[model samples]
Target: MDARRGWLRFIGRRLNPLTLAAARRGSAPFTIVRHRGRRSGTIYETPIIVARRGPDFAAELTYGQSVQWYRNIRAAGGRCELARGDEGWQIESVESLPVAEGLAAYGPPRSWVLRLLRRHEFLLLRVEGSGGDASD
Candidate 1:
């Protein structure tokens, strides 16, 4: 949350494809996410990087668990189109993944150990309906 990094994020949001693409290749760089626009219901994309989590494949979100993308997928429940490879996958909104389990997936834990050690509070939504996950 340094001022300089914050400023870069603000400016990065405005860069075009060519420049943004270049940035994505840099260290711990950004990844553009193409999601259905919340207000317009049209498709739009935003660039962000993996915030570091305790798991693999599952990236750590830098913002609050209640962030817009976090909330949107929680509401709509759809796939995330990753920018780099233009690959897409089914996404699940999970607020809880046992610390060790997530740690095994992501990393051994450094400063982010706090995230892993935290008490989890998440709402699980199934890819399908009630028949798949819970009786409710």
Candidate 2:
């Protein structure tokens, strides 16, 4: 692993539990992306920064492209559950976009240090449900 990713994994292991708890309480921007592990088959609830745009949601890939959650979602064929703003969504299509386009979804980086620290790639999810009922 790269130095930055190594450091991020080290910190994520310690901080993610707290973040997950806060997200489960329905925090803004902080949403939950739940997917199954690729090998272990364990369900994981990952906290991520998400922005709802129309019938879609954009999620930040802050920890770079190799994060387990990202891989799991991809491995599972772009299917996952999303909980955001006190609502649940079934995501169907997940597309990885370039930094230029993805940055628009995230608004702006909070700080130069953070901008430099995290990856800019993003996953744009197409929400599959209407009327609070998910089709798949």
RMSD of each: 6.5, 4.7
- Clash counts for the predictions, in order: 5, 0
| TM of each candidate vs. truth | 0.49, 0.77
Q: Write the per-residue lDDT of candidate 2 for residues 31-113, one digit (tens) a residue.
A: 88899999999999988877765678777676666888889998998899998557789988688755655566556553243
**How would you encode candidate 1's per-residue C-alpha lDDT over 56-93 as one tens digit per residue?**
13344544465556555555554545454443333443
* Residue clash pairs of candidate 2: none
Reference-based lDDT, each prediction: 0.47, 0.75
